[model samples]
Target: MKIIILGAGQVGGTLAENLVDEKNDITIVDTNLDPLRHLQDKFDLRVIQGYGSYPRVLRAAGAENADMLVAVTNSDETNMIACQIAYTIFKTPNRIARIRSHDYDCESEQLFSPEAVPVNHLISPETLVTDSIYQLIEYPGALQVVHFAEGKVSLVAVKVYYNGPLVGNALSSLREHIPHIETRVVAIFRQDQPIDPKGETIIEAGDEVFFMVASQHIHMVISEMQMLEKPYKRIMIVGGGHIGARLAYRLEKDYSVKLIERDRERASELAAQLKYTIVFYGDASDQELLSQEHIEQIDVFIAITNDDEANIMSAMLAKRMGAKKVVALIQRRAYLDLVQGSVIDIAISPQQATISALLRYVRNADIVTVSSLRRGDAEAIEAIAHGDQRNSGVVSRDIGAINLPPGTIIGAIVRNNEVIIANRHHRIEPGDHVIMILTDKKCIVDVEKLFQPINLSL
Candidate 1:
């Protein structure tokens, strides 16, 4: 599809780069000449330097031929105007805009619809980031909280601490505390690998936990484990940007939040905007300021400064200084290597996480489901096991019956809602979400073909 993007910031630039690799026709518009030139030099795509809301700018960038127009400028009003302009002038199929205010209601959206200008979707990254932070607050013990199936199954990650509440507990014994969320402690993340947990497996402190359970039952597990999601009495936030400001306000209702900024004017402005929070002007990285603010005893340290290295270093230093939970917002997605837990407790990559979520909405053709590539080697492909597929007479009558290549592990079969993890006795059923962990890049097509042999040539 022909896609036009407004804004040359990290989010837009990352999207253009990622989608360009997928062979999409991408064109970007930004007032900044530097980023426009950078995008042009790095990728084989059109770049226009001007206000995207301007008619000549939109037309010059080929918005008339665009399948989708995405507006994500720093100013919400500019993004909305750009999307509205593209929708009206180009008759674009989709107009996606990034808005700062989460309270934009139908009355506001109607002003930019197809009748006026077709704004198809609106997403506020500020709101999403706030929700993510709220999830962490609700489940302090979990390293990550991912809800799938519209809250049917929730995934939580926990790290074991020495002498912590759950030390030495049997895997089965903990279920008594698990509410009927149909909770399953499926795997243990040990040595950076996911290990299937057995009933006899003892819960050790320092072991990273991955539990899939019903959303309603999360608190039950917490109570049973005897670990409380401690209500943060105090939070220290570095960087007073949109993400930080929103997070501070959202958190201030429950915790005393202090947002520190290096910019005196911006800090003063944000102080007026936010209530129940203290905005201070200071050099956050300066150890003297951190000492003065008493960052060592803060329950949570949030590093959301615009600078990646600053955020990482501040978070690392805070953890070193004995802060309980250190959450850092990393702007650039390319620096994933530096955001590991060794740098911060929670490293939220906004661009990468946003793009990952968007892919689920844009693609899923012929493919039923797809997960991230592991070890950067191959993708795990999941397809259906039909009756005709079973009868094809390559016919060993089961997965073991097939002549398959090495490094192919059939992980699970979803017959109805139940996910059977390598329970080989169960025969493959038609309309099943059959899963295989592939070790090679090209085997994805081969694996898909085996599941849907009638389209073998595909």
Candidate 2:
């Protein structure tokens, strides 16, 4: 695919990096030469140094022949305008824009249409990150939670601890532990390496386990692997940025929420906007403020400030001060590696979350959802199997007989709203939503091909 991306910022750059490896033609446009030059040096893609919204710049980036145009500039208006221009002039088939303003309703025809704004899709990173954190709070103790089939099934990642019930047990023993519930262990990560889970594979204390289960049994299955954490009641958020403010708004109804912001005016604005939340006009890293606010009593402490250093300091302080779980938003890979697994419970990369959203549009298969797991080394995809056995490679094939690529596991199957754990004898039927875990993401194209309908005429 010939793609043109606006803004060489974190989101656009990361999207380009992910797509370039998939053999797509990517051209990134930005006013800043430093980031563009950096991306150019790192990836085999074109870089254009100019205003992304400008017509000449879009043309120079080959928007005329491009298959897709992604507008993700800092300004929401710029992104909207770029999409409009791409539709009007170049007739780009797909136009995706990063719209930050909550006021803009993408679904409203009055706002976006081919005759007007012309954006095919809108992605809000803040909203995505907020939803992610909300899901984590909903299912406590799970490191990652991805819902599939409209929340009927869930793929959860949990880190095993010494006290977990299945910590030292073999994979085969899980059935004995939870005989009533049907769950599948998709993949396990040990020492940052993918381990193909087998019957004899024993789970260690530090291993990260990924599994899929029926939505109704999420909490029950989680309890079998790890001692279920008490439902979080008190939540403290550091920073009043878009992500922090949005998260507080979403979580305040269910949890006791407090927000800390450094800027006095911005803090005042947030306090007025939020009805139930307690807004503090002080620095999140300030020890005095944290103590006065009783940070130690908080059940969850989330640091989502723009400053990576401030977030790290505040999260570490909160954890040491007795916060039960600390989740920090860290963008830099170096800082993320440094903080995660030590003091921070979870370090979220906004870029990774953004990239996951972008993958759904780019994937060749009929993928309803795609999640980058194990830090991009692996992926979990939910695809709808189309056609019957006569034309489909997956439909009507037995699980053990399918020619799936190595390192791929059919974790679970959702047929007619029922969750079926993948087994050797389970036969895949048409219209089934198959949930797969691929540790080797490099073979994603091959896996996609296997799920696609075969051309019988050929």
Candidate 3:
């Protein structure tokens, strides 16, 4: 597949990196020479240094015969225009744009039509990150929560604390703990290293465990791994930016929500916009302000300022000042590695979230959804099995018979609204939504091929 990616920033660069390894022709365009040069040096792909929305630049980046055009430049206007050009001149089959502004997104139904802006897909990083944080808040003890099969099933990551119920238990014992609910431990990470979960494998304290279960039974499954946390009621958000404000607006109705914005004007605007949320004009890192608000009573403190340093410092301060949980939005990879699982209970990455949203379109299969996990090193996918035993590798085959790549596990299968926990004897029928976890992303192509319907005419 040939793909022209507009912008060599984090989203485009990471998307290129993910696709380049899968034998795709990737070309990244950017106005900045430094990131373009860095990407060219780091990967086997072409990079053009020019305005992404310019016609000549798209031609230079091989947009004419490109299978897909992804516009993710910082400027929303640039991204939209680039997609329009790709659709108009190049006749690109798929054009995706990263649209940040809610104004554009609200009108997306009409604005993105072929007769209009011509954007085939819209990737909203802020919305994705906000939804991700909302899921974490919904499930108090989960490190990460991602839904599959239209919310019928879920894959949750949770850290095993010391003295947890399942700390010293074998993987096989999970069934005994929760006999009524069906769940599968798909992958486990110990000290940042992937461990192949087996029946005899013992879950140790501090291990990050990934499990798949029905959405309704998520809380029950989480309880077996660790003591389930009380549902969050008091929420505090730092920053009045897109993600923070969106989060506060979404959570205000259900919980006691407060928003802190350093800029007084933005705070006042948020105060007028949100009905249930309390808006304060102050810096998130202000110790005096945090204490005055009674940070100790706050259930969750989320710092989503544009500045990574400020978010890190504020979240750490809130955690130390007695906030039960701290969630920080950290952009830089270095800062994310430093603070994740330390003082910060959850660190959300906008780049990773956007990449996950873009991958489903890039993958070659009947892929319904894709969720990037373990910071882009792994992925969880929901793919529909197509064709029959003669044409598809997965259809009509038992779970144990399919030749899945190393480190790939089939967690569950959703067929006709019924969630079936994966078993070796279970057969995969056509149209079944197969939920799988790939701990090793290098096997992505292999997995895609498995779900792909073979061209019998060839």
For all candidates in order, the CA lDDT equals 0.68, 0.89, 0.93
How well is each residue in 1-458 modelled by candidate 3, as lDDT tens digits? 99999988888989999999999999999989999899999999998999989999999988899999999999999999999898889899999999999889889899999999999899999899999999999999999999999899999999999968998889999999889899999999999999999999999999999999999999999998889899999999999999888899899999999999999899889999999999999988889999999999999999999999999999999999999999999898788888889989889899999999999999999899999997887899999999999999999999999999999999999999999989889999999999999999999999999999889999
Give lDDT tens digits, candidate 1, residues 420-456.
Answer: 5443444666666555544443444445446544544
Q: Runs in model 1 with CA error above 4 Å?
A: 7-9, 20-65, 73-78, 101-112, 115-117, 159-181, 184-210, 219-231, 265-275, 364-458
**How close to the true structure is residue 261 of candidate 1, measured as C-alpha lDDT?**
89
Predicted structure 2, TM vs. truth? 0.96
- The Cα error of candidate 1 at residue 170, in Å, is 11
Looking at candidate 3, what is the lDDT of residue 364? 93
Write down the worst ten-residue block by lDDT for model 3: 330-339
Number of the predicted model whose lDDT against the real structure is largest: 3
**Predicted model with the maximum TM-score:** 3
- lDDT (Cα, 0-100) at 241 in candidate 3: 91
Which regions of candidate 3 are displaced past 4 Å? none
- Total clashes in model 3, counting residue pairs 3 or more apart in sequence or in different chains: 0
Candidate 2 achieves a global lDDT of 0.89
